[model samples]
Target: MTAFDAAAEFDRQVRTLLDRGHPEAAGLTAAEFGALLAPLRETVTERGGAAVAVAPEEGRVPFVLVVTREVVPVERAVALTTLAGRTKPGVVDRHFADGDLIRFTPTKEVELPDAHAYVLFDVERGEEFCGAVPEDAMAAIADRGRTPLTIEEGIALVTQYPAALAKNKCFSLGGSRCGDRRVPAIWISQNAPKLGWCWAGNPHSWLGMASAAGRAAAGT
Candidate 1:
């Protein structure tokens, strides 16, 4: 799609969020959500098609509207998520919810702006890295100058584009790691999207690491 088309697509995503009542889920009204995105919309329109242009050549996710934990906790975000055409809401793995022991903080390389709502650009599903170890995939992604997706970003991804989390095409959220070997991921479970984790050193043919070119406040 052309740059203008990409921008239009971005707008459509924003509308999708509103249509899904995500703003209400986050305790914000539609007007409030619109107000929050006003500046980002200006920036995106001004750039024309720069957002899509910078994406990876394949499986590029042009943009995603992310509502951070500050606005809605991860657990709540997971509950709000749903697979396409399915009424069953997405879920957080019981393991992840166990005592809240897994603190999936963003890796040092993935810097996010200090805003409850922002946009991630040029994301990729990392299908080429399928069956590669999460740790190794992270290194390869960095070598390519891309940053991995955090749990929040991963949720935002499938939240906006549920089809991206297909049966074997699921992705790992390498950007968020606990202080251990666990690498968080999102996949299909019982026909619904699920937030789970895998060992950092392990590899899964169905799961590839997810990454993004960068993140920025929408208004920026």
Candidate 2:
């Protein structure tokens, strides 16, 4: 498939997984999952590779860890990785630095490689991913004179709420990245670095490796 076609497919899979509403719905967070595959697509485009995820009519992901430089066919790309997972770590790790952007709910979290192992985020310099949203004085969205938003809406609305926005979901999960007790960590882009959540679409599918309960709640 073409790069745009692949991205569209990836986006569809994420939406499908999110729509499942399964609590185990906990899979890779939207950013994590998106970051994981986008780069592969880029590389594929550069190399003219057609390798991409086969549309999953079912829940199970038939294609995982696609790596190719381009000019390669999807079938060939798929078969090549089966030879050895040597390139897997580089792609995965590059996107998951402890300080990299991530998302998590009560079920699970998508942590970057360089993040704080104990905190599930980064703790270097002043940047840290507490992995939870801080409890601010604002009650609920309704309390703030607004309606409760869907995950996608919330992601968008949070951007304007200085007190409510975050770089990481660590704060939402109930934790403090720093001792300041001031602000929760923000979720940064895994690849883009400083960019934060745009919520271009809904994150109903935002999840990664979830626990049984999380899956149930997320409707996975």
Mark the regions of model 1 whose C-alpha exceeds 4 Å error after superposition.
Answer: 1-4, 48-50, 53-58, 99-102
* Candidate 2 local lDDT, 1-220, one digit each (tens): 6324544543453343333221122234655544534443343223222223333221122222211112222222222111011222101113224543223211113222211111010011111212212232112221333211112212211221222322332112122122223222123233211212222112212211100011000111
lDDT (Cα, tens digit) per residue for candidate 1, span 1-220: 5333656766787787787777787789998877776667655555545565554343567777787887767877787778777878898888766655337788777788855878788788888888999999999999989899998898888878877777788899989877889999998999899989999999999999999878778557
lDDT of model number 1: 0.80
- The Cα error of candidate 1 at residue 178, in Å, is 2.0
Model 2 deviation from native, Cα RMSD in Å: 17.9
lDDT of each: 0.80, 0.23
Model 2, residue 216: what's the lDDT?
8
lDDT of 2: 0.23
Worst-scoring 10-residue span by lDDT in model 2: 210-219
How high is each candidate's TM-score?
Answer: 0.90, 0.19
